[model samples]
Target: MNKIKIIAKKNQKEIRIDKFIKDNIRQNISRNQIQKLTISGKILVNQHIVKKNYKIKPLDFVEIEISNIPTIRDHLEYNNIIAEKINLDIIHEDEDIIVVNKPAGMVVHPGFGNYQGTLIHGIKYHFQNSNMKNFHLYRSGLVHRLDKDTSGLLVLAKNEYSKQCLSQQFYYRTIQREYRALIWGNILKEKGIITGFIGRDPKNRKRMTIFRNDEYHKGKYSITYYKVLERFQYLTYISCNIKTGKTHQIRTHFKYLGHPLFNDSIYGGNQIFMRKKYSNKNIEFLKTFLKILPRQALHAISISFIHPKNKKCYFHSPIPEDFQMVLQKCRKIFLQ
Candidate 1:
């Protein structure tokens, strides 16, 4: 059996026992399974079995035991993940790793409806050119992932050892990621943290939603830290640091706080939601900015991780042009 241990940290209070375990573990164990494990004494709080409804307190120690968890490669079909020649914005590359700046609209790897022309396909082409033969397509060295429409830095490993080392870092939450986002409205707090569980919206299959504190059984625990960089008349430019990388984490967190990301159609930022009354010119000007930024106004700006060579490395990517244009227009119109 594989053992998973967690130390409840700040902002993780009053979370149900089963919900806490589900949020922290990567394995697909349902709450019912967790309840079974608790009854079987496989899940424990402070070395003692507790009821599933028991709330986790700060600094509480939780341990879970379960069978080996299957990795992505184990269940995915890699036979169709073929190589394709495409341009990649490589920020850094070494024998052990390849760090690439993934552009917005590019899927990181092969998946349903996106098997070709992915970053993995391009990486395979790159590996072939570099004579790194016999690399597994599934093990194409992706340490982490970004959304298809989210531009950011991603590091891929060249060998199993490198993959293991990097993947462990992510598993231990040692990797650091930072993002720049333009969210709707002028938030009052200069800096704040949003904490919640994130899971797929029952109403919309394509989107994710932030579960309330009481709805712990619904989603994975997610935390987002944001600091306002610039406050515009109708929007706010902010820097985000995510403690937990859940699907649509930053977007959902901001939306939960009533400030959806600018132009994030799925999260309700595509249309105006702040105030009903604005001058026609202001509304049209906002529409012009939205046209400038066709996607959610978010960018992965920086990342830091431990290299396989036992050295620390940091990488940064400038906000892409479309996002930059929106910022410039906002500054010109709102600040001036």
Candidate 2:
């Protein structure tokens, strides 16, 4: 069992009890868990048990007791094993906006099978010590998200006004997003557009697919325009621009074109080629070394969007190291 304590700051005044715990606590605990703990007299605010949605005031004390202990070591070990480092690179920043270079293999939010050490965790850690408000429930000032395996630029809003202003740009499809990906298979065309309605695959729940005729799927329109920047014997370096954002839009559209990302496990290409390349001699070593590069080669290279405060067009972020590594390897093996 472990005990946790928190002291609310001046800006954190009037923050909901459940939200404060969720934002501050790094344990694998949920809102329901916090609510239950509060109801069961396990959580105290100002040395007294309060309601689940109790609004906290400045200098208020919060204490939480956990019967089943949750350790940060286990979560840290999981991140280390998966090669998800917690280093955030700030590309461009202002009082209203911040653009950060998100690393590969890091989930954007806390979800099922992933509850801690995500980008949300990093952002929370940043705000915990900073002079920022603690009442936001929607992504904590983040305007958009990059996929867990997709590394690159992301813009965050610092205040409520900025969040609304930037969110409108995304909703209006005025934000310009460009991605660079190392996809499997040879491409026939130099440039083309893939337009389709994307939805979750009926057969495979883990993947999103081009829904042909499913009513329940509620397909959303997506468009991806790709131009080949470089070509290898069996791979292509493509620059992709999306007209509409959907879940796994680039990956699904490329897979539909028979060019899945290299090493993508869900949409086709896996390490089967590597397994065939290295047959017997200590397979454990191969797995250990190769697992360091487990994620697909996808990157959000640049994002150009209107600034929330001034409406000025700004671009930020760069191609991450992992994507560059894949390109370098492809050139060495296939082009050379």
Candidate 3:
């Protein structure tokens, strides 16, 4: 149980325990929440259990304990999305949020072609099994999204208030997010920032493009800061920090710098870039290894943001297995 402590001051007036708590707590704790805490004996006054109507005096100490509520099992509302049971790698879970380590190739949410087998679907199924309340309220608690091919930490809200709080952080760009990717070609600079206007491709509707000065007004301006972590003969592992979340900000910006992410087909990464001709044996080996990781080699390695209910707490996600696996194989080959 989480605990919160409040002390009455010399100028404090005789008020109800619930009102004192509602006014003193940092979070927007409601009167109903305090009453529920009282029923569960979670509210204490001077180390003794107290009712909601208990009057507070100067120097009175109030302590509150919060625990997950036990609710009856309810079926998940499967609205055009199937909540099928699947193996989910849940990283962390609290009363207000859930952090998931999403694997590669799993769509973050359902789309036209994918009605099942999404991260949202699997997580919702797990919640249904646990019989947790407020977890099914959202579009399955998903507040943000990742590309189907990109893998790593993703956070989901458990209730309406938490959702709003998390969404606001992302909207204001206060959240810290960093991604690691294997890009084709060696970077000339150790670190640099790429600024460009990003928008849907004028030539192809399926892709995003970088706009020039004349076309800046037509596209949304975006910024990406990148630094080389490890370099290889034909590829480099880089970390990217995105300032503006356009459709394909990271991939498009890297391509604009002439280095698309390895194996990303949509942005001209599939072709053999950079190095000149190679031996047939080397070509065959590279092709086989690339085929093993058919999707783009990008992972959301780090994410941090304030907790919805707790002002001092922050959330984080570590690198997943797929990203490590691909990195290992590339390092083994390229470093040799």
Backbone collision tally, model 2: 0
Per-residue CA lDDT of model 1 for 1-336, tens digit only, reads: 487888899777787888888888887778876765564445667645566578999988787867422345443544456678999999999889889999999998766798698988898888888887666646475657899888988888887678767766665567899999999998989999888778789999899997776875556677788899998888999999987777899989898889999999999999975557677888989999888898898899999989989999999999999999989888899898
Report the poorest 10 consecutive residues by lDDT, candidate 2. Answer: 75-84
Model 2 ranges with Cα > 4 A deviation: 1-86, 133-137, 213-217, 271-292
TM-scores vs. true structure, each candidate: 0.78, 0.67, 0.71
Clash pairs for candidate 1: 141-157
Backbone clashes in candidate 1 total: 1
Q: State the lDDT of candidate 2 residue by residue for 69-175, as single tens digits.
A: 22465345333332234666777766787787888888887678987778867765665555653434345566677888888888888776786676566655678
Candidate 2: give the clashing pairs. none
Residue 38 displacement in candidate 2 (angstroms): 35
lDDT of 1: 0.81
- TM-score attained by model 3: 0.71
State each candidate's clash count.
1, 0, 0
Write model 3 residue lDDT over 1-336, tens digit each, in one string: 467777799888998888888888786667876765664455767655566678899988777765322222212234445677989878788878888878888988765798788887787788878876334463655666788888878888888678667765655567777899889888899999999878789899888998997876456668889999999767788999886666778989999999999888998787767536566666676677577778788888777889986564444566556557767877887788
| Local error of candidate 2 at residue 65 (angstroms) | 35
